[model samples]
Target: MNAADSSALVVFSGGQDSTTCLAWALSHYERVETIGFWYGQRHAVEMECREPIRQGVARLSPLWASRLGPDRVIPLDVLGEVSVSALTADLLVASSRTDGLPATFVPGRNLVFLTFAAIAAFQRGLKRVVTGVCETDFSGYPDCRDDTIKALQTALNLGLNSRLVLETPLMWIDKAETWTLAEALGGDGLVELIVHETHTCYNGDRRTWQEWGFGCGQCDACRLRSAGWQRYSQARSWRVWD
Candidate 1:
């Protein structure tokens, strides 16, 4: 990749997926910066894990430490004020009766995140924005779909009149593949960082420690992570046997 295409801004949320994406970006890009949003999420604890996860990821490899750049936390409380969802409010974690989308699906969250990430990337002279919005094994969020990201990428480039490429390394992959990807990017150290430092429970329950990570183990986020970890573990065991 050319120097112009080598820097990327990752939309990090200090969760398993975002942290994995951060490692992936650090491994691939010459320079990788991270941006997080404080949108009044119920799981606001994830915000607290951001720095620790970054520091842990950097310590996993000298190359990653050298490539990691400054981190930015943008306050987007407006999103919480406007959206009525389990992630932003004290609401029941269930599917919407009308739209069939999960209650944890914050409307326009990814769109807004990517929009701000684009602005940050533009100012920082970063051409690519990396995110971990996977369609597979997700909560059926419309904004997380591949079509939405592609459209937004085109719109962002046109609106800013800049060549800003939005990259989703986890778009088609399942959560099991995501864990494998993280291991591939930074080995067992990266996975350990994710397990010990990342937060994903919608309720922000950091007190409970699952084998996969810290979560309530009942919310959609925790369930997905748990299932993925089981699958990944089983696959790894099978490979070892083979």
Candidate 2:
């Protein structure tokens, strides 16, 4: 990307991945804009998590706002239409991870979000877009794969005809690796920032860091976060001796 033309738009859910993506965005793009969604998720606090991210960006070294300017925090309130998530129901919320795709999967969610965000980026005269979706932690989400992203990128370019680059910074990184990358990119406190500050729980519980910023212990989000933090924390401790 030309330094003169490095403006970008990021799909930010204000969650652990997205917030780290935002910080990563600030490092590369000359200007960064954030696009958030409120797609009737079972837990509303996910949207509210955007606040600390906004604050974190403000506290960056060069200052995120100074680089990205003001971001567009879009709150898409299609509460009734987006009922595909397993997080929408009660009983299933406890036992819905056995299937191939998993019920917690939101139907066409990232698709819709990225499509809309692409339009937003185009409208703003920006050529680049960043998302934090990862195949490493997809569990079963088809949209998080690099193949899917690349295919979508091709179709989007054909339709838009203006060169829209969709980049997934976390495409190949697992949860522990993602934490490591965020730390490498944002310094030592990156993992803490994501675990304690950013929210990704489907149950919307901010009860403790043991869940590792994910919603509930039962959900996939919580499971991934739980395992990752455990491994990362222990590995960090061992590294202190090495």
Candidate 3:
């Protein structure tokens, strides 16, 4: 399928990476829609930021505004009900004893997300599904791995008997490169929108405003974002200096 003419559905979480992926989709595809999930996350505020981010992204370019389609929010509260993690519960964020993965790793979260995204894509006749799951500069979630996404993509296509394409624009890149990609896709405005509108705090603390964005600045998510922003900013500064 020609990506320039294809339609895509983005699995947006109103976070930095997903928002970047959304911009990437809008830049590449002819039509792009977004789908968010409410799994009773501790940082449910991310859902609230979805619409505003969509509007902000659309305002970036007339082409994007024209190509951007409707948004959908799926109620996957069952995942939260069935899983015990720092993201779903009030427990402190740490590593698990068995696998050393972060406590924020909601088991099977991405798997279920991709499955439902496929269903939504099938219903909407969207041939491509975009996600922001990354292995680099992430909290070590197994489902976010490239291998896992590829496997799930194969399973989804076989189970649905459809030619749905799973797209991960941020899979191999780190957070700094993610920022760079967003800038490349939409320029400084997009970066500013991501910093001001997107929510990535695992603690759901919208109170503290960091240079990277709004976050508690202490959680794993915040640290990754902050570090990435620092690297991204420093790199840009050095380029300007050169």
Candidate 4:
């Protein structure tokens, strides 16, 4: 498939980074589709917001929305059964294991997500897979590392005998830069959508909405997102949401 005119499947999770990556894919790819995982994580509300977020983006960016395709939500309940983390549950003791991994880290989550996305893309003749995992701002998840992604890409290609480009738009960027990217992708409305619509809190408390979306404002995800938005909000002169 030609790189200039190829379709992409975004490994979306309805979080800040994934949502931004979705917008990035829509603007860059010839045709864009999304696949979200429902692995029985504690914050399942993230999945629930996917359609509204997609539709909101479509309303704001019609041209890119025209290239958008159906978004699929896959069930991976078995993955939840095997993994014991804060994301799945409060099984572990320390927030970070002795090995320095956070309690929220789900074993093989990204690998499974990308592998499944690759298989789906290969079957559909798509050559690109966009993901929102960022090593820079990501909180100690080994699977979110570039090396892991690169190795998985190689293995997927060798296993399937097809070159699948794994695109990480936020790989090297920090959270502040991510907010900037969201704004650049579709201006203030896109930024507003990310701030108020997407769910990133590990605790899944939707009691209030802040610059970092709806959350408890105390979870790891919220802290990182809030800190990033603070930095981004100060650095640029964009219109803030009401």
Candidate 5:
């Protein structure tokens, strides 16, 4: 794609991967916009978290507004009737396997988000979409696989009135690589940006994360993120982890 056509949109969640993707989008695209899903998942808590996220992005890089505009954040309520995700209920999102799509899969979560992002991008004359859907360190989510993403990309392009490409920078990269990528972009400072901001709790416990922004520390998200933090720490210290 030409430089001007490099404009893109990111499926933002104010969470770890999405926050990183938000930063990545700011750096990668000539024009970058974002779409945030507002599916009924613990409303007030989630919305409260998002306010600071938007402000954080704006404070860190005002150019984000220049590219995508600060008001472009879309709060979509698409998965209202769907009672499929743990993020909305008390049942823990079970095993990290793929025998079948899990209840926590959030049925059509990414599909809905991406489709909307594509639609928004198409309308705005933007054609590239970026998301941070990593299979590694992810809980064996079917939606995160290369095939799923490719299929979605094709479906979006064919079904939409215009063409679009969904870019997944963190698709193949593991948590460690994600950490490395963040560092490459902004160094340990981005690590701080990640620490103070991103939410990775399955139980939605804010207390567990007040000081360090860590969740249960055992869920797939926290474990993977911890590994990334440790690796970055060791690299900085050059001291063997014991």
Candidate 6:
């Protein structure tokens, strides 16, 4: 790879998608670092799962493990004060906003995350930011769109007067495709590590373990993941994971 495709800093959340992206970066980049955000989300499983996930991946894929450097978690307590989404709210309603935005949509969450990640990457002399923002299998968050990421990338580069590559490995792919990518990257063991360890539930429920992970299995995030897992399993001629 050339200088343009060298090292990377992944905006990791210890969730399934982000974990896959981190692995993707590790496979492709010369070096990879991860940054997490503690923005006062109601479901803090993603934040809490980071260390164990790192350890689990290390055990599963040692080649990528050493590439995983110290992951930083930036605390942004003020973000909770300004947003009324299900992620930040004390009481979350299973509905949409008055203007039709998803109830789980935390306003400017990705933007803030990428901005901070960019700053950290800049400081570390890293010019690439890998994120797991998927437009195909998501909860309709506007910030997850490709154009939004491009715009932010441009603005960040112009503001800092530095060229930074914002990489989104899962941008156009759906859940099943994501699973396929994970299997491609590190086979079934890596996929199992992600399914059992990473948390993707909005309700923070991990009691019922499924093929896709532990969640209520009814929430938007759970449904998407479960559906994808089902599709991927069927494609492999394996019985559905119960």
Tens-digit lDDT track of model 4 for 1-242: 47544789998888889889989988888789999988899888888889989898888877877978888888999999998788887553236766678888889999999999999989877889999988998788899999999999999999999888999999999999999999999898999998888889998777877756788887788889999999998888554442
Instruction: Kindly report which residue pairs in candidate 6 clash with one another.
Output: none
Query: Candidate 6's residue-wise lDDT over 1-242, tens digit each?
Result: 66545889999898889989988998888778889999888779788898888787767777787777778999987888897788898665368888888899999999999999999999988879999998888899999999999999999999999999999999999999999999999888889889888999888887888767899887788889999999988887754343
Superposed model 3: Cα runs more than 4 Å off? 1-5, 95-97
Clashes of 2: 3
Number of clashes found in candidate 1: 0
Tens-place lDDT per residue, model 2, 1-242, is: 57547888888886888887888888888888888877667777877778776776667565665886656666566632655566554536545455567777776777878888998988888778899999887557887888888888888888888788898999888788777778877786656667677888777877755646645676778788778777877787898889
TM-score of every model versus the real structure: 0.98, 0.90, 0.97, 0.94, 0.85, 0.94
- Ten residues in a row with the worst lDDT in model 4? 90-99
Off by over 4 Å in 2: 1-4, 63-65, 79-83, 88-91, 97-99
- In the range 105-153, model 3's lDDT, one tens digit per residue, is 8989999999999999999889999999888888888899999989998
Whichever of 2 and 4 has more TM-score, that candidate is: 4
* Tens digits of per-residue lDDT for model 5, 1-242: 58658787787777778777877887777777777777777522544566577567656655664665443555545575664566665656544324465546676777787888888888878778888888777876678888999999998888885668889989888776777777676556666777876776665556676433747776656677788777766675763453
Q: Residue 39 in model 5: shift from native, Å?
A: 1.1
Candidate 1 per-residue C-alpha lDDT over 29-80 given as tens digits, one digit per residue, 9 for 90 to 100? 9999999999999888999999999999989989999999999999999999
How many clashes show up per model?
Answer: 0, 3, 0, 0, 0, 0
Scored by Cα lDDT, where does model 5 land? 0.71
lDDT of 1 at 165: 90
Which of the two, 4 or 6, has more lDDT?
A: 6
Instruction: Tell me which of candidates 2 and 4 scores higher on lDDT.
Output: 4
Candidate 1 error regions (>4 Å)? none
Check candidate 2 and list the clashing pairs: 32-68, 201-214, 201-215
Every candidate's lDDT: 0.92, 0.76, 0.92, 0.87, 0.71, 0.87
Better of 1 and 6 by TM-score: 1
Output the worst ten-in-a-row residue range by lDDT, candidate 2: 89-98
Error of 3 at 77 (Å): 0.8
**Candidate closest to the true structure, highest TM-score:** 1
